[model samples]
Target: MAKSVAVIISILCILAFSGLSQCHEEPEFFVNGQVYCDTCRVRFPTRISQPIKGARVAVECRDRDNGTMTHNAIGMSGDNGEYNLTIKGDFENEICEVVVMKSPIAECAEVMEGLNRARISLTSKNGLLDTHRYANPLGFITSNPLFQCTQVLAELDLSLD
Candidate 1:
């Protein structure tokens, strides 16, 4: 009977210790960066002094040979134009599509002449962000057919190494 009690206590202790260890574990790792326009062949500058503080951006992972992938989460750039994406458990190996999401209340100034959407795709190696592998600086926009423009910028060739 004493042996059984001791075994039960040991099991409980192990479970408790394991839980505590998990609490101390670091957060799921991620990479943060900004999207830019591919200006001709050169990359557009990263410094934004404008008031584009609430621009929305999305990174959609597209599966190869399979249909369009789904990423329930979305990210937005801050006033300084920066974003951090948390990529975790069960991410697929595929090319990602990064696009700009239109705000419900878009301003006329925001809609510039010859301005379109932006997109980029690359081979993601696990948790690393491939700043170099990005979509075309000029993205296509079929969302608004009335005044669609082909706005292109340089948004590739970023290196963290």
Candidate 2:
């Protein structure tokens, strides 16, 4: 009879410990940033300022260079020209960039021709913002005028167990 009680008690203890571990597990972190027009020198606010809804951003991990491990999430800027993106997993010392695309959009403004796209650097892990990068502004304005948009995202550091 004592042996039976001991076995039952051990099972209950195991279950309780397992549940505690799950509850204490850390969740994936997400970081966010924004893009703006260099010509205007203002951010892309959704409702208040520049519209930044339906904007797509790609966060590629530069350290690993694993295209499969790259994370891509979509975001929209608020009225204050700010955007927020969520990244899954822990990314310690991970180098990332928030890239914008320009291809075929309204090719009207000459300023926008050279200042339509932008990028922001997302350095570190657990969702953090780092620096801002600008690439191919002139090409973006003159090459493809149909697609013009901005993206803000992050890169994550994948941990191996």
lDDT of each residue in 2-76, candidate 1, tens digit only: 999999999999999999998654334243554333222222333221223455666666666675775534776
Best by lDDT: 1
Off by over 4 Å in 1: 1-29, 35-43, 46-51, 103-161
- What lDDT is obtained when candidate 2 is compared to the true structure? 0.41
Per-model C-alpha lDDT, please? 0.44, 0.41
**Which 10 consecutive positions of candidate 2 have the poorest summed lDDT?**
152-161
Candidate 1 C-alpha error for residue 21, in Å: 12
lDDT of 2 at 5: 100
Error of 1 at 12 (Å): 19
After the best TM-score superposition of candidate 1, give how far the Cα of residue 45 lies from its true spot, in angstroms: 2.5
Lowest-sum lDDT 10-residue window in model 1: 145-154
Please report how far candidate 1 places residue 98 from its true position, in Å.
2.9
